[model samples]
Target: MVNLIYDKSPIFLQNIFISLKGIQIYRQRYNKVYRKELKILNEENEFNLQKKRFKSFIKYTRKNSPFYSQKLSHLKKEISMSDIELLPMLTKDEIREHVDEIVTRNKGLLPMGTSGTTGKKLIIYSHPYDISRRIAYLDYFKAKHGVKKGMKRASMGGRTFVPEKQKSHIYWRHNYILNQLLFSIYHASNENIIYYIEELNRFKPQSIDGVTTVIYRIAKYINKHSIELTFKPIAIFPTAETLTVTVKSEIEKAFRCKVFDQYSSSEGAPFIVENDKGYYDICPATGYYELERIEGNIYEITVTSFYTTTTPLIRYRIGDAVELFDTLPENYTQSDIKIKRIIGRKNDYLVSNEKGKVYSAILSATVRKTEGNFIECQFIQNKMDEVIINFVIEGVNDKKTIEHSIKELMKVRFSESTEYNVRFVEELESTDGGKTRFIINNLNRELS
Candidate 1:
C-alpha cells in the first residue's frame, strides 16, 4: 500500500513525503548532542581529547554491553589507553551472531545496513545520540568547504524513487525541508544524463554530494558532450568509493570547482576527510583507528567509533584497507592520522594467471586508462583465466581504439594467456546500494 502511493504519487506530494521523512531524520541527526560534537571538531588538545573519548566509550561499552562485558572481563574494569589494543577486534560474523548482546541500548535505536561491498553485510544499530554525533562530524566537514545546513544540495544517493516503468525525462525529486534536491542514480543512464544536467542547471545547487562513481559518470557525460553548466557548485563531495587522482582531476575539471573527498561507511565508521591540502586526515574526535598489517605497506582498518556506543565498534575489523607510511605515526586523538590511498575492499582482488592475485589498489590504477574517451568500466572475473570487461565509451570517441588499448593493457597485467573480453554497453550496472562497482570478483571465495 505504501509502495503504491510512493510510486504513483505526484512529484510534489512525493517531495512532501520525503521531506516529512527527512524531518524525522533531521531531529535525530541535528539535535543538542550533535551541537556538542561540532564543537569537539575544533577542540584543541595534544592527544588527551581522543584518549578521553576512547576511555569513555570503552567504559560505557564494558558496563552496558553484555557481550563486551564478558569479552573484556579479564582486563581491569578501567581499561587504560594502551590496553585498547588488548580488546579483541570485532568482525562482521561476530556482530551478526551476537547483535542483541552487542547492543548497549534497546530503545531509541536506529538500524543501518552495511553495503556488503566486501561480501559481508549486517545491520548495525545506533543510538540517537551516536547518530546525531555522526551527522555532526559529516556536517562539520561539509561546513569547512562552504556547504552548511539548509543549503541546496544535489545528491546522487541510492534513491529509487522513480518507478521503473515510468516514461519521462524527469528523474529527480525535491526535499524542501532540508533544501536538498535528490537525483535518481537508478536513472542516470547515458540517455537520461541530459535530464540530470538540465535539472542541475535549473536547481542551481550549492553543493553536490553522494556516491563518487555516480557523480563521476555524470561528469564524464558533461565533459564528453562539452556541455557547460550554468550553476557551479561550491564543492563536489564524493563518498563511498575509492577516488583515484585521475578521477578527482576529471571531476574538478568538469565542475570548475574543487572536489572534497570524505570517507565514512553505511555502518558509521570514523571520518577520513580530505583537507584543503589534499591529504586524507582521520578526524580523531570521531573515532580511534588501528591498522592490522596485511602485508608490506597495506593494512586493514580497525576502528572504535566514539558515537557507536549503541553497538560498540571497538577494534572492529571494518574490511577496508589503506596504504601507509613505512613507520606508522602515533599520536593522541588531538592530532590527525594521515592516510595514503584508501585501497579497495580487503577481499576484493582479481586472479591473475601470472601475477597470482591483483588487489584493488592495483586494479584501480589499472583502470586509469579510461581517463578519457571512456566513462567507466566494471571488471567481472568469473574464472581465473577468463575476465569480462563491461564499459561505457564516450559517445563521440572511436570504439576500436579504446577497445584495443584496454585489451593491450590487460595483457601486460594478466599475462598473454589470460582471456580479456571487452564489451561496450550504454549503461553500466550499479551495486545493490546504487554504487558503481568497479570490479565484481565472482570467483569462489575460498579459491580467490
Candidate 2:
C-alpha cells in the first residue's frame, strides 16, 4: 500500500521520499560505531586487534546463540586463536535450518538479503553495531581511492525503487542528505540509458559504486556511442557480482579511472578489497577468515564476521573461492593477508536488447528454489531471446519439475516472451582457472 503510493507519486515527490528514507537509515549506519571504526582503519598491529575480536566473538556466540552454544559446548568459555580450528565450519544449509537458534537477538535487527548466487536465498540479520561498522569499512576502502566523506557520488543498485508504469527518460533519484544519486538498474534500457549518462554528466559524482554489470553496460554504451562524459570520477567500486578483466578494463577506459574490484557477501562476510596499489588485501579488522586449501593454493573461504552480532556467523563457509600467495606460514592468521585473485561469484552475463543485460546477481534467482537438487547449474545464452539451463543433478529429481520451477523464476527477471532450454547434463565444464561459471554467454561473439 505504501509502496504503491510511493511508486504512483510524481518524480519530484519520489525523490523527496527517497531522500527521507535515506535520512532515516543513513544516521543509523554512520553513527558512533562507524566513526570509531574509521578512526581505527589505519591503526597498526591488526594481529592483536583480530585476536581480541575473534576470542570475544566466539565467547559471545557460545553464550548468546542457542545453536552455537550447543555446537561449542565442548570448548571452554575462554578460547584462543588456535582453538578456532576446533569449532565446526558452517554451511548455508546449516544456517538456514537453524537460523532461529543461531540468532542471538530477537529485536533491533536489520535483515540483509542475498539473491542466492550459490543457489540459496538467505536473510542475514545485522545488529546496529554490525551494520555501522560494516559501512565504515566500505567508506574507509573508498577513502584509499580518494573518496571524501560528503563527495557527490552515483550508485547503480539492483533495487526497483522506480515504478514500472512510469514512462519518463529520467531513471534516478537524488538524496540531498547524503549527496548521493541512486540509479535504478531496472530502468536502464538501451534507449533510456542516455538520461543516466546525462545525469552523470550534470551531477559530476566524485566516485561511483554498485552492480558491476549495470556499470559495465553504461561504460559499453559510452564507448560504443563515443559519448564524452564531462565529469571524470576519481574511482569506480564494482560490487554484488564478479568483475572480469575485460569488463574492468572497459569501465576504466570509459570512465578514466581505476576500477577497485571488491569481494564481500550480502551476508556481512569479511572484506577482501582492492587497494590503491591494485593488490587485493583481506581486511583483518572486519572479521577472522580461514582459507582452507581445496586444491594446491586455490582455497575456499570461511569467515567469522564480528558484525553479525545479531546473527553470529562463526566459521561460516561463504561459498566463494580465491587464490592466495604461495609463501605463507602453516598456521596463517588475518595478518598474513595475501590474496592473489578473487575467483568468487560467476563473472558472466546474459545480454538482452530490451533489458540491456542481466548478470549473475539477477540470474541467481532461477536456481534459488532447486538448492539441494543439483550439484551446479550453468546458464548458456546463444541469443538475446533465449537461455539454456544446463544443470548437473545431485540425485533423482525430475528434470521437467526442476525446469518448470526455474521457468517460473525466469519470468521475474527476464521478459515473459523469452524462451528457455532446460537440459540435464552429466557434468558442466569449468571455465578458466577451474572456476565454475553459472553463466556462459556467447553473445559477445554476436556483438563482435
Instruction: Note the Cα lDDT for every prediction shown.
Output: 0.76, 0.79
Task: Give the alpha carbon lDDT tens digit for every residue of 1-448 in model 2.
Answer: 9899998899999889989988887988889888888887767565677788888888888889999889888777799778888989888788777888899988887777554553335667777888888888888888877887789999998666767577777889888889999998766667767888999999999999998878988999899999999999999999988787888989998999999999888788888898767668887777888887888768888898877888888888887888877745777656675877888543266776567567777676446544445556778787778888887776665676788877776764565778888888787756566755567766654342
Where does candidate 2 clash, by residue pair?
Answer: none
Off by over 4 Å in 1: 44-46, 329-336, 345-448
TM-score of each: 0.76, 0.85
Best by TM-score: 2
**Deviation in Å, model 2, residue 23 alpha carbon:** 1.3
